[model samples]
Target chain A: MSKVYTGASMSLDGYIAGPGESGFDHLFEWYFNGDVEVPTASDMTFKLSRASADYLTGYISQTGSLVVGRRLFDLVKGWGGRHPLDRTVVVLTHSVPEGWAPADENFVFVTEGIEAAVAKAAEIAGDQVVGVNGGTIARQCLDAGLLDEVWVDLVPVLLGSGTPFFEQLGTAPVLLDGPVSIVPGDRVTHLRYEVRK
Target chain B: MSKVYTGASMSLDGYIAGPGESGFDHLFEWYFNGDVEVPTASDMTFKLSRASADYLTGYISQTGSLVVGRRLFDLVKGWGGRHPLDRTVVVLTHSVPEGWAPADENFVFVTEGIEAAVAKAAEIAGDQVVGVNGGTIARQCLDAGLLDEVWVDLVPVLLGSGTPFFEQLGTAPVLLDGPVSIVPGDRVTHLRYEVRK
Candidate 1:
């Protein structure tokens, strides 16, 4: 079975995006601060520290599918129909958007909810990990007990206010286990934690 | 000159405290979860992991004084009149409390402003570091261009919602220099980032 996980580059104040959809320039600075090249499946390429390059490439290689929220899907226009990771993306939404369908252009819409979407993503992922978006979708997966891990690229900037990493959690205090891996990168700390079963 | 810095044990979701003033049990778990002893000036002694103990002891051993907001001074009843760290505390408030006075029982009340409070604290600290409380006091120091560093004991739990660290910044996206030190403890990662001057 594919391991289900969620991750994001969160600011020091725990925001994934600052208020009014801002602060990406600071939160994602690590991707552009160093000299080593870490290219996506598409045109975007990241200049990262050697350590980040090693960690990111390994992460990208292991992720086979992603389960994201409709909000994110709409935000990037479905990642231009091909996710930067070049994997199958299962979008959990109330209804499928117009002009997009199932399993075409690397996008799959799931109206059945988080469980069904994650299940489909895991099936598509096979042995690879199912990467889910942080915040809303991640909270749903966590609440449903389908989430196995939480990976965070902790950026150093304090966003002050913005969209927090996981908001409105069903559980008040969600205690997690070891950040099994702590890979220090430029301007970001790649921390991977195991969700308590 | 005393180096000004602010720190707190923050949740993975970037909250210093959870909603309704909750979540300290999860946030301060690292302080009580270790075998090595790190004693403070007061009767309170923390059992910390060796790394955390060393890091914390070194942090505590430096000659210091704390500058904090009136709200925090009132919160713990002035840490029971003697702060756990056993250092002089400068309370920044609009007016001194009804009973407390200057230079008495390790507590000094400063009603002037953030600058005067920090200045008094710095005078007391001398060559040592002048520590500021996170959140309100820290924000003032940063805005005043007085804060030099940020120390965070990053815990693994996600509080979801609560008092965020450095809530409002006069300057958005305050760029920091480095986590010059990263010490991993049993359940906490002690991170120190230098504030850009």
Candidate 2:
């Protein structure tokens, strides 16, 4: 079965983005310096180390679809109608735009709820991993016990306040196992873990 | 010259301790389990790998003194009057307890302020590294640009809400350099960073 996972690059203070920051440029600056080699779904340039690049390459290759939030979809203007992952993108929202048009056969918008969105994404993903993006969507999946893994690229900056990566789950503490891999990049530390059953 | 550094074991969510938790038993549980070798001043039994033990042994041998918050000092009952670091411990507070006796001529309570506590700690630290403890004190020192390095043992736990390790600094983002070393212990990943000047 395909595993469901979430990933993001966050600051030392666990902020995915700083206040008033529209994009993740600052949080992801480490990827652009042309030193490390990591495969990203976006067109943004990145320099990732061989290990990081290999890991990302494997991750992207294994990801069959992605689930994201409407806010994120709007931030990048629907990723110019094509997401970087090149996989089918499922956008979870309260309501679909009246004149929404599919940029490609891969873009999907679900208004019912995160479960429906994830279900649709999983269906599309088949035996491939389903990737969850956006902190809100990720948290929702985590709360629902629908996520299987979490990957984080820890940037060494204290944003102090911004969009927190983790919110109140209202559930008992979640235990994660294995930083299966801890890759030290030039400006980021990559950590991977499997959600304990 | 002695460098002032802050260190703590934090959750992936950036919480130093869970809500209502009195001690770091959960976060530092890995240290208590005899497995990886790490140097500690306390006689508490430990099982450490040669590398981790060496690293810790070197670290403890170089630490000259420690600065901690009153709350933490009270929590451990001043580590039983003598701290594990085996170095002078300065407790920062607003007032000193009446008739407070020196735990062993090494415990000092500074009612003046963080500056005074840190200054006194530095004096005792001399050319050896000065260690700062507690989230509040560490944040204060970081904000004041008095901290030179930070070492964190990242534990894989989602403390939905708790005592956050980093708080709003009300200043621009503070950059850090290095994971100088990333040691994946049985239950924790140890990370070291040099605070960028």
Most lDDT-accurate candidate: 1
Q: What digit string (tens of lDDT, one per residue) describes model 1 on residues B43-147?
A: 788998889889888887784899888898888888877898989999998887888776675998888899999999999999999989888889999989999
TM-score of 2: 0.91
DockQ of candidate 1 (2 decimals): 0.75
Tens digits of per-residue lDDT, candidate 2, B74-191, equal 7787676678767889889877756676334768888888888888889888998989984889888888888998888788887866776766574658888987877777668878
Could you tell me which 10 consecutive residues in candidate 1 chain B have the lowest summed lDDT?
Answer: B96-105
Estimate TM-scores for all models. Answer: 0.96, 0.91
Error of 2 at A6 (Å): 0.8
- Please compute the TM-score of chain B alone for each predicted structure, in the order given: 0.96, 0.88
CA displacement after TM-score superposition, residue A165 of candidate 1 (Å): 1.0
Error of 1 at A183 (Å): 1.4
What lDDT does each candidate get?
A: 0.87, 0.79
Highest DockQ model number: 1
